[model samples]
Target: MGLFGKLFAGPQVDMAKSDANRKKMRELFNEVVENGQDYKLIFGFTEDIGWFNYGFVHGSKTKIGNLIVGWNDNSQTIVVVPTVPDLSGCGDATFYRRNEIRKAYQSKYPTDAFIIYPDRKGYIGINVCDWLEDEKLYVYVSQEEEVKEFTDFFLKRFQTK
Candidate 1:
């Protein structure tokens, strides 16, 4: 390859490493979901929406990381758990409830945001402007089947008609 080609070439990714990481994430997610039978478990990724130009321009969503959420109707609590691929292990879970959440909706842009349930604090991210008042959680699931399952289980229990 020429110098120009090397300079202009997009960032290269190690597919093998990415695949291994994905596999590890899946394994962790499965284990968490299996043990969380009492609560409705959903697998997905989270995003942080950034702001620029005094809120005039909304930057593209920045992927925070992947997670597996478990919510229990009886307890009226929701837990956001992380799925890390590294040897360091996963982080602690953040808990929320109906009172904390302001709104819940299925995002039209599935790739960006699938199911969003933003709480009173709204979207939490670095340099994020809370454009919407009282919005909370954000979840994005790529698979259609999993999305459907999550929607059915979550909305049915959490949201009121």
Candidate 2:
């Protein structure tokens, strides 16, 4: 879109307040996670974690909640938990190729921001702005043991023959 086109763009859909859109996004997230992939959900608001530049780009902070981090085995891609407006009050879930990933690991900071790099071009910092936390559940799966435990629990609750 050109500059004038952007200025004339239609009103953005407020997914945060729409049930249909919320359901769609939730399903999309589930599908992304259920394909024999590994994922972690971290609880806490964006501010507490700190991805300052991203926050600035997004126009605001992520509402306090869970941030889903997942690794897709088939593509070797690390999926950034897209902001679900209705659920997160942030934005939408977006994907990035593993090669595009500059880094992916837990932040060394005291607050522990689970980070995925290439958060922004030429920028280095905690990338919390991408996830708009809203849920209360916090499930951290950083270690091998934790991943196994989470897998067991997830399969038991969500798997179907």
Candidate 3:
């Protein structure tokens, strides 16, 4: 190793891990397509990791590919966290409530960005942009692999069913 290289930090081997994460995210997103009726979503690691920064509550199991949603009556425009989290009302109408859950989960990882796609009823759809805030994927991606990542994350969860 060069003198300067040894003195400073080394290369990041975590890139592989990030790619794996992206793939999983794609899987999860596709799985949610069938039941996108009412599923709010968020993009906080806490949502999936299950923990709150406030320490009041913990253990939030994200529905794999759901978006974190919220409503602001005063604004009358539906303010969402990280990204907008509306519902589609595909399966359960509880998507509205799910939005709340996303917010609750976001307490811990505030910077964990996510993308919420809502249907006509202002219902959120899937995590179209779960990795948007990821530093690894700072640039826009339009490759087939990107889609696969979301699909994998969504479908994998439904395998048990």
Instruction: Tell me the spans in candidate 3 whose CA falls farther than 4 Å from its real position.
Output: 10-13, 34-43, 47-161
Number of colliding residue pairs in model 1: 7
In the order shown, the candidates' Cα RMSDs to the true structure are 10.1, 16.2, 14.1
Cα-based lDDT at residue 160, candidate 1: 38
Query: What local lDDT does model 1 show for residue 67?
Result: 62
**Which of the predicted structures, 2 or 3, would earn the higher lDDT when compared with the native?**
2
Candidate 1 regions off by >4 Å? 1-37, 49-61, 85-88, 109-119, 124-146
Backbone clash count for every predicted candidate, in the order shown: 7, 7, 34
Candidate with the greatest lDDT versus the true structure: 1
- Score residue 26 of candidate 1 by CA lDDT: 48
TM-score of model 1 (CA atoms): 0.48
Reference-based lDDT, each prediction: 0.50, 0.42, 0.33
Give candidate 2's TM-score: 0.37
The digit string of per-residue lDDT tens for model 1 on 1-161 reads 99999989865545565445445544554455544556655545566556556567655655456465666767776667675424134556666666766665444453434343455655421111112112134222223444565566556755533
The model with the greater TM-score, 1 or 3, is 1
lDDT of 3: 0.33
- The residue pairs that clash in candidate 1, if any, are 117-137, 118-135, 118-136, 118-137, 119-135, 119-136, 122-135
